[model samples]
Target: MEYMKNYKHWLANVKEEERAELVALASDEKELKERFALPLAFGTAGMRGTLGLGTFRMNEYTVARATQGLADYIKEQGKDAMERGVVISYDTRRMSYEFAMKAARVLAANGVNAYLFENVRPVPICSFAVGYLGTFSGIMITASHNPKEYNGYKVYGSDGAQLSPEATARVVSFIEKRDYFGVPEATVDPSRENVMGKDNVKLCDHITVMGKSVDEAYFDRIAKLSLSPEAVAKEGGNLKIVYTPLHGSGYKPVTEILSRMQIPYNVVPEQAEPDPEFPTVKMPNPEMPDALTLGIKLAETLGSDVVIGTDPDADRMGVAVRTNKGEFVLLTGNQTGVLLMDYILRRHKEKGTLPQNAAVVKTIVTTSLAEKVAASYGAACYDVLTGFKFIGEKIDLFQKTGAHTFLFGYEESYGYLAGTHAKDKDAVVSTMLFAEMVCYYKSVGVSLYDRLQEIYKTLGYYAEKTISVYFKGLDGMEIMANKTKALRKVDIREIAGWKVASTVDFLAGEKTYSSGKKEKIDFPKSDVMKYFLEGGDWVAIRPSGTEPKLKLYVSASATTAEKAAEKAAALLDQMKGYVE
Candidate 1:
């Protein structure tokens, strides 16, 4: 009844063209309820949903409401915040550009200055622009590797990181106080094209359309992150790489960095351009091997041994390397993170530039092998909660305390960041560094795959696997919560014949040992649980922040690769039963 009332209200207020869709849904009670049952959730990562005419959908009205809430929060921060403004960028998603312009208009309506990008840009550049322009905040309109039917809005603080939970809560509070229809309307017309490039063109008094200068500055800063110039100079030309953007926004920046480094690469022509439909892949996620099929095929034809794919927003990167048997295998995010960390540390040490307090950061779900690798080089490895925002927070802390030098940070979900140039995962920098990494290994008479094997052989084999279970529909959130609660109540003392040495309840913020000792976890409370096995392997279960899914991660280390893989597989299978 409430949903129907809300639906009627929207139907009455919206434009005549928008009313037809709402009126059509009148006969389908289920569809109407699904659309109007609740407002699209604005979480720590901001909002994401299918594009449609509904309270729970991503539309002009919802984008405006979210921006209005953000604008109100900025106003509370005072005149400096209003003067500082917000930087807006979008990916090549359906409605991405329109949503971006709508947000900029809403900000301008609220008297907040908006730095709007002239064209499509990726996530890292948007994050970089927030800091580069000293904006009060930033907004990126992208779903970041989700299906083409979906789009999202992500907010970043002036620190260039995703908004913290506390800040997000404040924004959500303001969002709840406003009615969807009552939010301020756009004050400026966004119809004019390429206004950002024109010298005298201003969309409004509060809007500034940004152009290539921000991009060049970003490129220049990340270019300096190159660690192995000599190796790149030697092998960059010979080491051919095949790259696919998967019809996302990565085409330009990824290729630009490679060209600047003189790394030889061929783009997968089919996926080289931006297409909102993302026609070539079922989903635009690089983490999925199917998305890289075109890239691998192109690599084979070009006699290239390495293939790289970046997601829709270009914040995450996926890599596949040729093996000794001349077969290309996709590298897991854990493997890539470990390999990159090892390469970075080894090079830093070789050049005598490795900081005495050097540190590497990883999500608790990431491979434990990173700690071993960091320890080998006398660097410390710190574990944070599941989000990159925590990693960014740690970087800020390290900068203030001078306790540790941040060298690299990564997660097991194909996201990585090596430099602080951007406070988030950067596929652009990752691509550049990985290309150089491939060259560096080649110069040493080894391939990326070969080097990965060598690292395993030297440091002990490590294997990791992640399983995600989707919970769809209206009851999805409740179901996920009940499942997590059920798991917490169960006494999971042993998993796959491995005794649980400790159980860490991140929500409880405590770790209970088998010996009856309990220790407080130094991180914020979250709905996650981890089990430390007696053999040093571990398992973690956490609900995804941005999507309606529960993820189970298993990590195993053994003296041999096969054994480690077998152990991880067994653990995952057993853990699957618990969640079910």
Candidate 2:
């Protein structure tokens, strides 16, 4: 009866186009249950769901409801907070612009100012704008590399990082108190309103436009992260690079940075423009090899030395470099992170800029090779949970304690951040850094692939892979929960012929050794299991927070690359069997 009450409200109020879908979906028992069972809450990421006509989906009503909650939270902070206002931006996804406008109108209706991007922008820009404009908070309308049928609203705190769990919980509490059908929103035509003009829409008097001013400020800050200007000056002109935005919001910033640095580069013509449908790729994420197929093809056509692809919203970057055999191969996220960490640290040491208290942060699931690279320069490395928000939280902690100087941060999912310029991952800075790193290596008469191999030889060869098993639709959640529950109880004594010395269940926040000794894990509780085996090999399992997939992570370290590969592959195979 409660679901029906909400359903009738939506069916009565929603636009004509969506009414048919809502009426049809109401008759499907399974879908209706899943959709009405619960509202979308903040996961490891923010509020993300498939696009459709339900409380579980991301639609105009859901966006408005979320924004109303945010507005309430902001107003509760005080008048000064409300006056400080909120910033809104969107990526190039279906309904992204509409959602952004809806958020602005909701905030406006609550007497809060809104600074909206005039055009599509990246995720980092939203983060940057939060601090740059001294806003109360920020919202980015994006699915962030999800499939075409998905959209998300990511909230950023005043410090320009994704809202911490504590903050998200607060917002969720406010949201839970509100009625979905009764969230207040002012009527505003985003297309008809200009930042400089008087508000034609109710409560939009405070809306301001952030355009070239914000973009320039963001670019200026990112450009300062370049560590190898001399290398760029020497080899920038001849460096043949091909870039693709995957039909998202990175084209302007990525190309602008390269051109400003005087680096010669070409864009994958077919993918240079923003297309909401993402006509060229199956998914917009660069982590998949196929996401860069068009970019790779363009690179080959231009005889480029490297190919780089940025996912939608431009936070994650993937690289494909030419090997010694003239074959271009995509580097895994671990490989890319390791290279960047080593390059950043090595260059910092050479320049005598290496802080004694310097530290690098990575997720527990990321490659352990980062620890070695950070340690080689006498720097400390810390591991957090998977989300980059934790990394940002650490940076914020360092800023207060002065115990550690933040050096770099990365995740295994092709996300990396070099400077504290923005708390979230910044592919704009990463693209600049990677470009400079490549140029520097080329100046020294070595290829990017060669440099990677050198690092592998110096620091014990490391091999890693993440295998994801996805379950779709209504039953997916149950299947994943049962599998993970069973996995938690499974008795795993050994893996890949090596004895399991210990196992850490993050969900339990405890680690138990083969000798029966137990210790508490001093981190956030997550449904992740990590097994430490003999001989520097390990395996981890966790469900993806943003998608309907269970992920298995394997990391193996050995004296030789071949041995490491063999060990990792065997462990992954065993884990796959368990997951399936």
For candidate 2, the per-residue lDDT at 228 reads 88
Q: In candidate 2, list every pair of residues with a backbone clash.
A: none
Off by over 4 Å in 2: 189-191, 194-203
The lDDT for every candidate, in the order shown, is 0.90, 0.88
Task: Estimate TM-scores for all models.
Answer: 0.98, 0.96
Query: Which lDDT tens digits does candidate 2 get at residues 1-580?
Result: 6566667777888889878888888677777766766677664366998888878889888888888888888988999999999988899999998899888888888989888888888988888889889998989999999989989999998988888778788888888787667777767665666443322233347667678888888889888778889999999999999999999999999999999999889999999889989999999999987999988888888899999999989999999999999989999999999999999999999999999999999999999898888888899999999899999999999999999999899999999998887899888889999999999998899999998999888989999989899998776877898899999878899875789999999999999999989999899999899999976578999988876789999999888999889889999998898889
RMSD of each: 1.3, 2.2
Score candidate 1 by lDDT.
0.90
Q: Which candidate should be chosen as best, given lDDT against the real structure?
A: 1
Report clashes for each candidate as comma-separated counts. Answer: 0, 0
Where's the lowest-lDDT run of ten residues in candidate 1?
192-201
